[model samples]
Target: MKILIIEDEKDMLQNMQDTLVKQGYIVESASDLDSAISKVGVYDYDCILLDINLPDGSGMDILNFLKKNDKTEGVIIVSARNSLDDRIRGLNTGADDYIAKPFHMAELNARVKALLRRKNFEGSDLLKIGNLCIDSEKHTSTTQHGEMELNRKEFDILTYLATNQDRLVSKSALAEHVWGDHIDQADNFEFIYSQIKNLRKKLKEVKADIEIKAVYGIGYKLTLS
Candidate 1:
């Protein structure tokens, strides 16, 4: 999973990034509104942890930008502003959840996981495709025959493809989602192909019901048998 943390406090931002990264998410940050808007425009994230107050403008406005752009990334308002009106406005404006400042990191992590589960798997932790089952939280998958474990990048690739399902995911989008900042440094898609190849082999080894089908000259799609 990938997360973008939009927070102004340096300590808080670093803390959130560290915690989420430890929890196995690709995390990035923006300390102000402009940077946040720019990042949101260029990249897609599984979840965005947004602080209501920023150095430049209200995070509420960024919510509008996200909605207008039709980005499906889940938003969780993490604000020191504990006003009911602020909470209502954030949710009304399209936030998936809200967290007040001085909150426990455990609670924040739980909310993020719950939001991802709801967004990606329709409120279920288990992503079921035919006889195959994937549990994102546990980072494991299983078939009728047995269970399988994928490395970080391979698991990320599988999760990204599963989120898009049958939709053809372009190489650029897949790279951004899985590789994040490192995607810019990669001169070619050799890494993506390598990871997908490994992931495919593992799925086949486990007798998975789904396949990652390449759409020659375009992208790859997740197809169920």
Candidate 2:
């Protein structure tokens, strides 16, 4: 999953970024409201960790912008403002959850995982498709035959396909979601093709009942074989 951390505190922002990265999430961060708005406008995220107080403006403005534009990223207000009014305002503004400062990284990780489950997997940790079972919490994929050995990008691609099973997933969307902001640095989508190729071989090795089907000119889709 991808996460955006909008925080002004240098130490706190770095800490949050490092923690999420260790948890296998693609993370990007902004220190002020302007960059935060710019990033939010241009990219998509699975979750956002927002600070109510920014150097340039209130994080509330960012939330308002998200709502006005109908962005569906899950947001958690990670701010020092812990007053009831602050919490109410944030929740009313569309934050999915809130965490006060002086918090543990483990707790923050848990909140992110919970919000992702609620948003993507219908609050379930297991995503089952055909004979394949994916434990999103554990970051593992297995079939009735056995576990599939996959690299990080391969697993990410497979998980994404599982989430959108039976639906077309545009290659650009897959690259953006898996590679995060770094997708802009790529010259072409040969990298994506490479990952999907290896993932397909692994799936076949495990004799998974699922398959990743290419859509000729547009994208790919996952379906039962």
Go through the candidates in order and give each one's C-alpha lDDT: 0.90, 0.92
Q: Best by TM-score, which number?
A: 1
Off by over 4 Å in 2: none
Write model 1 residue lDDT over 1-225, tens digit each, in one string. Answer: 889999999999888988999998989999999999999998888999999999899999899999999988899999999999999999999999999999989999999999999999899888887778889888888899888777888878888888788899999889888878668777778778888888888888988889999988778999897
Question: Distance (Å) between predicted and true CA of 52, model 1?
Answer: 0.9
> 168 in model 1: Cα distance from truth in Å?
0.3
TM-score of each: 0.97, 0.95
Best by lDDT: 2
Among all windows of 10 consecutive residues in model 2, the one with the lowest summed lDDT is 181-190
**Residue 148 of candidate 1: its Cα lDDT?**
74
In the predicted model 1, the residue pairs found to clash are none
Model 1, position 34: C-alpha lDDT score? 98
